[model samples]
Target: MATRQTLIEFIGERYPEIFALALDHMQITGLAVLLAILLGVPVGIWITRNKKLARYIIGTANIFQTLPSLALFGLVIPFMGVGLKPAVFVLFLYALLPIIKNTYIGIESIDPAAIEAGRGMGMKNHEILFLVEIPLALPVIMGGIRISTVINIGTATIASLIGAGGLGDFIFKGISMYNNNYLLAGAIPTALLALGVDGLLGLFEYKITPKGLKLARS
Candidate 1:
């Protein structure tokens, strides 16, 4: 009970700082995921047209996925230097594989007969893509985005080390000073943010998914 009260008091004292840090964390995460979606979705679609390139592209993204987050951050430091740019860039890299792979899988998994029906209806390639393919593929693509967003939220804490200034500042400070309140202050919010974003995205995924797909799943 005493510890709980202490934590509450600590949060009360540091509310402004915590709010600002949370905003910064969200900004970094949002930008990284947006960039990933923009680039990844297009590349994912493009690779579908080129199976040979798909292998190389997905393989390269897999390599980035395999790298430790800290190592990737360290590698970018010399070229991009410290702060938000590098942090976002690293997070973007981390986000790419899931978005790209899921998109590929999503589109590729569509029945060939569906594409033939669209073509039979005299739909152009782009029309078929936008109408049939994307709608069907959306849930899977959103799954990747949801995965990426959660990963970014958690990883953004480490960005504080590069002067990116997120909840991680509190976490690392807590570690250095051995302050449990500080650790809780940072860790709790990060976890909450991840869970909250994931839930919201899950809802959005359901809403955007074609009704037929939902029925099929059911």
Candidate 2:
């Protein structure tokens, strides 16, 4: 009973500080994922317009995916320096592959017949893309975004190493001090944040998926 009370007191005492860390974690991750979507989706669309280039562009992003996260952060440090700038850049790179690949796949997967039908109706290329292709592809693209965001939540913890504070501050401090409560305090919240984002995105995915596609798949 006394131990339980102590634990409660411990969390209550640090709740404000921990909450601040969580907000930092969310802010950094949200910014990175947003940038990735903005940049990556366009790149994906452009690359698909040239099949020869798609392979090389996607190949390069694949290389970044294979690199160790810490090493990638280290690589960016010289150019971006420490703190939020470097951290956001590294996470942005980390997010690119999924968004790019998914966007490409989503767009490419559309039926040629459907595209032909659009052309027959006098739809311009851009019109077909915006009206037909993108709507159909959105679910897949959003899945990638969801995946990347969840990944960023966990990865953002490492940003603390570069002096970009987040929940990892608690994690590293706990590790250094051998405090289990502090460790759980950070780890639990991070996990919860990831799960929450995943769930919310999943709901959005369901909402946005085209009705015909949903029926076809069903």
Candidate 3:
């Protein structure tokens, strides 16, 4: 009870600062994930068309995924320097593998007979891709987006080290000062933000998923 009251007091005292930091955090995460979707989805779709390239492309993204977040940020610092650019770049790299891999997997997993049916119905390649393939593959692709969004939110805390200002400012400050209130202030919000975003995306995934897929899953 005391701890909860203390946290509430701390939040009350720092609400404005916390709100600003949260907005910064969301902006960084949103831009990174948006870029990942723009590039990753296309690359994913392209690799599906050229199976030989799938392994190599996915492999490269895997390398990015395996790199420690801090070290990746460090490496990027040389070219991009410390700021939103480098931070978003590193996060963008981190977000790529899941989105690309899931997209590829989702599209590839589609029944060939479905494609044949589309062709038999006089559908063009682009038409089949946009109308048939993408709709069928959306759930899996959304899964990737969800994964990437959550991961980005967590990792984005570290962006403060590069001068990108987010909740990590409070977190690192808490660490330096040994202030539990500060730690809780940052940590709790970050956790809640992740959960909130994931839940929203889950709802979106359900809504956009093909009705047939949902029925089949049920």
Error of 1 at 201 (Å): 1.0
Computed on alpha carbons, the lDDT of every model, listed in order, comes to 0.95, 0.92, 0.95
Tens-digit lDDT track of model 1 for 133-175 = 9998998899999999999999999999999999999999999
**lDDT, residue 154, candidate 3:** 94
- Candidate 2 per-residue C-alpha lDDT over 49-136 given as tens digits, one digit per residue, 9 for 90 to 100: 9889999999998898899999998998888889998999989988999999999999999998999999999999999999899988
Candidate 2: segments with Cα more than 4 A from true spot: 1-8
TM-scores, all models, native as reference: 0.98, 0.95, 0.98
- Which residue pairs overlap in candidate 3's backbone? none
Cα TM-score of candidate 1: 0.98
Per-residue C-alpha lDDT of model 3 across residues 1-218, encoded as one tens digit per residue: 99899899999999999999999999999999999999999999999999999999999999998999999999999899999999999999999999999999999999999999999999999999998999999999999999999999999999999999999999999999999889888988999999999999999999988889999989
The order of the candidates by TM-score, greatest first, is 3, 1, 2
Compute the lDDT for candidate 1.
0.95
